[model samples]
Target: MAEGVGRGEILLRPLPCRAPPPDGAPVTGTLRLLLGDQLTRSITALDGLDPANDVVVMAEVQAEASYVRHHKQKIAFLFSAMRHFAAALEAEGVRVDYVRHDAPGNPGSLDGVVAAAVARHGPAHLVMTEPGEWRVRQMMEEWRETLPVPVHIRPDTRFVASHDDFADWARGRRQFRMEFFYREMRRKTGLLMADDAPAGGQWNFDAENRKRLPEGERLPDRRRFPPDAVTREVIALVERSFPDHFGTLEGFGWGVTREDALAALDDFIAYGLPRFGDYQDAMKAGADFLFHGLISPYLNAGLLTPLEVCRRAEAAWAEGHAPLNAVEGFIRQIIGWREFVRGLYWHEMPDYAATNHFDAHRPLPAFYWTGETDMACLAAVVDVTRRTAYAHHIQRLMVTGNFALLAGIAPREIEEWYLAVYADAYEWVELPNVHGM
Candidate 1:
């Protein structure tokens, strides 16, 4: 374990730190807030600010971890990401009031944290990026109605399609299919179509993307970003605080900064995109990554946007750097299924979580947590998930989700695992994919 930090301790293992603002410069206003999957950049709150008078507040709340028995890497990922982001804000000359999970006198829940921050800081107003989960949104609504200061919730701009846009698309529809919505998005965005026609002759190359690897086939080594000091600190904290949780820190390699995330994206574009379309859905023994883009963490954290990623993939296609199938397949992931799932979540949620359409009731097998299953495919996928807190879409849907479906594991139980393990999981994107798709 890394030295010094522990659960809930406000240990500032600086990624890149800023010298404190000129000593004794009179403190003025502060804004209490929350940052989970949607709320990333400080600009979501900072852009409307009088920085000379406003300080931005963010916290690593214990309620998040305790709400579900989260996978260890998932807990480590969020806490580390938040710490890195907080450091970035401080570097930009923004005053940040950060509450660490293990800090003394810290509140375990967002409600308590925000209330305490407001009581002490007394800002003129509270601003936040609207949360993606119904429960969090409800809490925020309650706080807005009752809190001392006026709370301002801003719409997230990370996605290409808005909540209203998705609702409008679903109007008068009886059955919702992602392909139809994706075609509309393609036309609206001019992604892979030329004059409203698919760039080649096909709208989807999924037929070509599903071929599995032949036995004993060697996969090119998956690229990984080395953990920075901040991530190391967070890993130490997880080791000390969550010894019983699933997952290990031995091979903890994740990007902690925006620059590292960008690098990871470029690496995928160069090394993986050519084969991404061909094996995008393939599963095999010991092969965890099959040419999948690993930028979900950055995208989920607001470090990157769907538009920017799509634009880059499109640009790669335009330049002949990658083939149409590969580029289109990757683009579809972001603009296609990603948006569709979010819409389905918002459309059916609160109820969606309870819709055990198949009514699966068996407990999730013990090996899901231990990755000790006898099935080769499942063991490989779960092992990778336990170590990295990540698995590409196919691994998630077909392998793990398929096993859960076969074993009759409760949808709620399976949903909890998906939500708890992946860095990209937010209720809006995670729920519909797990429960319905």
Candidate 2:
């Protein structure tokens, strides 16, 4: 059993076969299938869960972790977070059918484990939030046909904009631009909007956000969460299972739980957000994290919601805790670029992955994986990526991605590299960003 996992939570031992209640005593339980990314407690799938009969099924399968040679820390962070989330659910008396990757008879794939859980629980229905990737969405559709019970794939409500909203905004437009979509989201969410106009009398502050860091400027200290026992176990598991994966786990400091994520958010808003805009695009040697909010992984993984993050930043600006430029830029990232890419991904996926406008077919350079290059910019970004599995947008777009594009590296190869290396690299976000690049 995983550390802190309560009794009856681990599904290793065979559960007693639940006999049909006499004359339909209430209804059978709803089986909730929570993917690794759907760790939020209030996710739509769990909205009306009844602890008495409902069972939440979560699995740390090998397939997802090994799909693209994910960063070791990435794997560890997810597993640790999932485990923590399961434990928290169990503490609330929610029955969690948790499966560890190394558990005996582990099927090693999401569909397999979910099927096993269904067979064991004999649920009346299976519920899950919509997946983030096109391939996973296809798998969910397959589950609808294959599973014995009804499968409900609810829309993920954590995002600011829905798929329909994006589609409506994109309809009949020859060119899809994020600026307009962002303005719509601002109006829709009423974020940074005053009555009918945008805050600061403008919709964008990119012009004011490009100042280079002044010489010898003191950077704020970032909050780091040293590995606790749960995370340490996950680290050990990842190190033992994935010795050949990219990136190191030596200095793994990411917060895995919701509390930790909130603390990191507060830390960023208090210290980093004030100076975030000025040097968000600046890169300096020996400064891997310069005033940038290191909360993308948390946000992407559902520990933080997009609207809540944007609202907090907006509040910071309103309360004079951070400047308008910094707050607006940060909010734009969450509500604007993040939502826009997600919209683009779902809108054009299954075919979007095949669209390579450049038609470049050169192989990705060896140094993208090894960081063994002489070019200062490329080497620095790759080095940071290898050590931390993180690089700000500018580092991704301007440095590594630019090098790949200029060198005519195959889009698929570079796209796979981005997905494999970054902790926050999911297909919906990474693919669109790579395509845009």
Give the candidate number with the greatest lDDT.
Answer: 2
RMSD of each: 5.8, 3.2
lDDT of 2: 0.86
TM of each candidate vs. truth:
0.90, 0.95
Per-residue C-alpha lDDT of model 2 across residues 103-142, encoded as one tens digit per residue? 7777877778888888888777788899899988888899
lDDT for model 1? 0.74
Candidate 1, 135-197: lDDT as tens digits: 887888899778887777877666667788899999999989899999888988888878979
> Scored by CA lDDT, what does every candidate get?
0.74, 0.86
Ten contiguous residues minimizing lDDT sum, candidate 2: 1-10
Clashing pairs in 2: none
Off by over 4 Å in 2: 1-9, 12-28
Q: Give the distance in Å from residue 60's predicted Cα in candidate 1 to where it truly belongs.
A: 1.0
